[model samples]
Target: NAGVTQTPKFRILKIGQSMTLQCTQDMNHNYMYWYRQDPGMGLKLIYYSVGAGITDKGEVPNGYNVSRSTTEDFPLRLELAAPSQTSVYFCASSYHGGGYNEQFFGPGTRLTVL
Candidate 1:
């Protein structure tokens, strides 16, 4: 059922450019999240949404924005991208919040800013 899907598996962007990473899940999950992983660091949450029309910023939301207008779609927007923003972004979804439920992650989108 396409648990989760992300477009443009890989991207190369010039510094100061903007882009949008698309994420969609067909599982009807109640929780959706956006995370970024640096070369040698753990995943850091950028944004999350508990449900449609309910969104919140996460640990690292400085250069990004997210919107969850529907349960199945959560898109991340990156404005004025910088080299530090170059990382593999992952989109995940779960039926429940917290650690109670297993989150299904989509194949990450590798972004490179030069």
Candidate 2:
């Protein structure tokens, strides 16, 4: 099973454009998360979902949105993309929401908004 998968390994979007980053997990994880990593910086959570039908914004949710309709998929939407949103985005999933479980990370999507 593909633990986690993300589409478009790399992208370059013009400012004001919009895009959706797709994420899917075959492990049936209960918790899924979206995070962004900037150059020389640690990752910052953008959104998370504990389960299907339940989603929440994370530390950096501005200009971003997420939806979780099934245990296997969580997609992130970027609206009016800006240069500030340029970063490497990663999608991760875990069986537990806390530290008890290990999170499996997908090969990140590198996005650059010019």
Candidate 3:
């Protein structure tokens, strides 16, 4: 529980399945984010929250949901998985929101859908 950590390093899902990607940080960061990276592409923000109970959608929120019930936990839920959702999901956290601050990233969860 030093930095951001993601559970289930890898997963495979059939069409229409569902799962939750768990993320946790022990640094007490106020800002948390969920991002997905497609093959050969940069990270696309899926959701973010400034603190507990303050969640918002990011650049790509379709088919995904997130909730922040505590300062250290942020989970991303995938409903009705699809082929388009196949990618590596990353969780990040920052003490502050700005270009000057550093964001810690989790190892990522590799999800494959068919």
On the 0 to 100 scale, the lDDT of residue 13 in model 2 is: 100
RMSD (Å) per prediction = 0.6, 0.6, 0.8
Inter-residue clash pairs, candidate 3? none
lDDT (C-alpha) at residue 89 in model 1: 98
Q: lDDT by residue for model 2 over 1-114, one digit each (tens)?
A: 878999989999999999999999999899999999998999999999999999998999999999888899999999999999999999999999988899999999999999
Q: Model-by-model lDDT, in order? A: 0.96, 0.95, 0.96
**Candidate 3 — what's its lDDT?**
0.96
Q: What lDDT tens digits, residue by residue, belong to model 1 across residues 4-91?
A: 9999899999999999999999999999999999978999999999999999999999989888889999999999999999899999
Which sections of candidate 2 miss by over 4 Å?
Answer: none
Q: List the residue pairs that clash in candidate 1.
A: none
Each model's TM-score?
0.98, 0.98, 0.97
